[model samples]
Target chain A: MSNDIQDLKQPLAKANAGLDSVHVFAPATVANVVCGFDVLGFAVNEPGDEVVMRRTNKPGISISKITGDNGRLPMDPAKNTVSVSVEHYLKSVGRLDVGVDIELHKKMPIGSGLGSSSASTVAGLYAIKTLLGDDSNPAKLLPFAMKGEELACGHGHADNVAPALFGGFVLIRSYEPLDVVRLPHPKDLWCAIVFPDVDVPTREARQIIRNKINMKDAVTQWGNIAGLVSGLFMQDIDLIGRSMQDVLVEPVRSMLIPDFYEMRKMAMDLGAVSFGISGSGPSVFAFTRDEQTARLITGKLKQHLNSIKIGANTYVSTINDAGPRVIG
Target chain B: MSNDIQDLKQPLAKANAGLDSVHVFAPATVANVVCGFDVLGFAVNEPGDEVVMRRTNKPGISISKITGDNGRLPMDPAKNTVSVSVEHYLKSVGRLDVGVDIELHKKMPIGSGLGSSSASTVAGLYAIKTLLGDDSNPAKLLPFAMKGEELACGHGHADNVAPALFGGFVLIRSYEPLDVVRLPHPKDLWCAIVFPDVDVPTREARQIIRNKINMKDAVTQWGNIAGLVSGLFMQDIDLIGRSMQDVLVEPVRSMLIPDFYEMRKMAMDLGAVSFGISGSGPSVFAFTRDEQTARLITGKLKQHLNSIKIGANTYVSTINDAGPRVIG
Candidate 1:
């Protein structure tokens, strides 16, 4: 071994031994953060997924246990997001001989547009990486996790996985080579996320969107995308709010979400900087200047949804800068 | 007199008397800047238009003299881009009663897709603004110049005018309120501009483009636009070059520019960082790392165009950060 490896041998041994079993919590993400469909996303504090990884004598990855999902997820390692990601990770590091058994605790609702699968996928890969004492860069694991997403959603996109892995706001600038840029998060920025008690399958949500868009609308959307990036970099809250108008995807997709327009109007009226459908929504997210306003908007949205008999879960979160973390 | 008026009166008197006839030069601009169709542009240092504004006793705007063009431009103030912009500027400042005789000196070829009309419009308004001692923000004058573009091209777009008026790179964030953001310009960034001797009227150039674009292409374009903006702010030249791919506009509009693909290939092979049809085509521009590379690329592009019996004008310039200025 090289001197560097020799020096790290002590800590590496302790890490591998002590971390025979490790649990990681990966936060939920709001993808397609208004005006940045398929490009931008941010991590929220709650409604995430947890994955537990334990070293085993067996020579391959396996799904030992799954919870919080009520058996909705597959136990097959190849089919499950968490196990699939762990499998990919093991294969990537040429550590297939190092066996791992994964347990997924899906704390977030499935197909609710809260990036439930992405959270589990990220947490599983992160847990295995930690347990194995891997010193590789975190971003290198994105592709493995993205594979998990592809298996779950039938399409590969990194907007959710990126933020769920790196935390804060992230921009997937390009997908071919997967260039992800993590933007500086404003401390005062808060998110009001509302998940109504309705499920919109990712495939169905995507199908509603037109394959073509008017050139004029495309120009407007691109301009806003530029403005949104500028706003995030400059930390101009109002500019961000103004740029959150999604002229391309939201109009068509929002039609599938009940009371979307009403909720958006209410949120904006209550001083929410911007409001739009999150991911392939049934969940809607709004950005606010402060935590208090975020809470107020969330409470009001939930109350309105309840009064209308739609039932909802609301979350008030400042951006989670620390993405997945080890838990005792 | 009010305090502001009292303060301005002295300078106004001196400006009117000392600057009876003001000459202003506005640099030509490359609009759309690949990937950012209709919303992005940057200013170059040479091949611009010059306008002279002289105070007259007549209580209206008049086109006193026109040079460089073979009587193609209109003589009537209402019909000419420069005079129209000047008229709007005077009306905006409530100085319609203050008559002016304008002369447009077209240094760049008309309809060469080098923002020829935009330069003339900016120069004229800037001249009048200087002669009348209007110390207003330069950006506030964008609408007047944009109106000039509308009258000239049958479409009002500010991508060209904003950069020409402000100098350097510009993004029109929103059109309703006309939010133009001046992007940070890298000091070492150089442009290799080659204007082939041909006229592609802006109207004809615009007509060939489709009113709708594939959604997939739009996403790619917007993502690259974000990358380009981030690249500019971070001074990542390679990122800028990578993000300069235009899948939406170029595929359609490039059909109008003769030997466009051949010229683009030559420029790229000769160390051009990014090569594309500038503005509406006929004029092609490329970004390079330094002055030497810029000159080399320009010479090769000119030679290649000449070999095809197409005469061309080549310019090597860094981004012009100082926009419209009064010249002796």
Candidate 2:
């Protein structure tokens, strides 16, 4: 045991974590803008994840505590998505072997389409990066947060991940080497998210999707993907809405979420430029040109979901331009 | 009665007979943005056709005459593409019979894949749109210009028309109803167009394409289309490049153009982020991140085409943010 103790050599730690106070903000994101499937997204600001981290004399990387998760999440670092991402980022940047403590305040729900985990991942990594004197650039910080995302979703999908790191719309070309690009964010647009209280765990929802899509459907999917991306860049609301339709996933997944059709219809009827499942459903997001429409969509979604007897959390927000910032 | 009818029409007075002083700037364009196949394009500044239109007391839309088209373009308003388009634009909006004179300045060659005909169409329609007080929106202007393009190529394809009307990358959804969406313009990217003085008449080129596509290829094409549009929207060069591949028509069409393979290889090898046959080629456009590389590509294309002793014209440029602009 004594010899093995040398082999272990005390787990890696966070550097300069306790030396100062740090705050980080991570943006909410849209994943799978139609044909991008697993690899395109942009950030929104209105409702996002903010963390205020203060360093402590704590012996290792540990969660000082958490709030707003309704005491549902674990405090254990390995089991916690945010804690692990923070630890991973510090270790990769050679900020390891230093003691630190992390305090994450979850502003958005874990399964919300607002990219709750990605925001948290960004916030956690950012908090640690700041505590360590900003050890990495956006490019460098991406993978660390991505690893955290993989832990939560079982596979890496950067549409949401890249935005969480870079704070804009992003296109993920490949996950193997992690090729990602940030797209121009259309000005004056807001994103409205509706998270129903019903839980359709990511694993379960993913399991229902066919492993291989029919090539015909795939092409249509990609066409729409291109169209949607084009629409976003051009700021064409009608085209963006056209490009958001996904015959592949929505048909199957929407069935799992109660009143999905009704709520979606309501949102569209109320002028949502686009609406679709935010990553595997139970939660959804809609695009609006203005704040009034966003609020209207949120209210409509809430009302529809309620009529189905399901409570929902609705946030009418804007694109998250500032990816990760810190607060206490 | 017969004498009165003969006296009434004869050659008709010149529509544009008075002032001859107006600056004009038409933009070169890229029709069919890779995977979009039948429907995507954008106009670029420089290397465009400039046709200055002026007003005259003489009634009816007859050209006082023209330059730069080498007397190849018809003088009859009903027969000329630009004339017909202007006539159509006016008729469609119920603003008919405007008097105008015109001159054409050939900035780009007659058959460069860089949408040479679109330049003429846009210039004429734009001038008319301006002279008519701009009652139509960007969307409405497209059909008029498209009809003009049909004169040059004998068919209306939006990839060229949409961009010519709008300033950025555009998606032509369906031609029947003329649905179009302008996507965002990429930043900091350069484009090099090499027009080998060989003509691949649009009529023959369209015939060369097989009407029925392999479902497999169709699927791939749509997927890439989605990816490509998303790439542009996301501003991901690699994705755009990857998505530029065409499994449908490029292969067959490139065969008709001499040395097409070597030229493509040259463009790719010369650090071009992407390269493709411009419209119905013999002309090709290569893209890069900077002006230096763009020139480098243009030079490579010129040399390659020349080695085979094919006459060529090369233009080093970038994506056109403003499709068709009026010269003040």
Isolated chain A TM-score, each model: 0.93, 0.89
Best by DockQ: 1
lDDT of 1 by residue, A46-135 (tens): 878988888889798888888888789999987888888788766655567788888888888888898999999999888987888876
lDDT of 1 by residue, B111-148 (tens): 88889999999999889878877775677777788889
What's the lDDT for candidate 2?
Answer: 0.71
Compose the digit string of candidate 2's lDDT tens values, residues A176-228: 44556566656877888888988888778777876545544554565566666
Provide DockQ values for all models, in the order shown: 0.70, 0.15
User: Candidate 1: misplaced stretches above 4 Å?
Assistant: A1-18, B1-18
User: Once model 1 is optimally superposed onto the true structure by TM-score, how far is the C-alpha of residue A222 displaced, in angstroms?
Assistant: 0.6
Best candidate (score: TM-score): 1
Which lDDT value does model 2 have at A45? 76
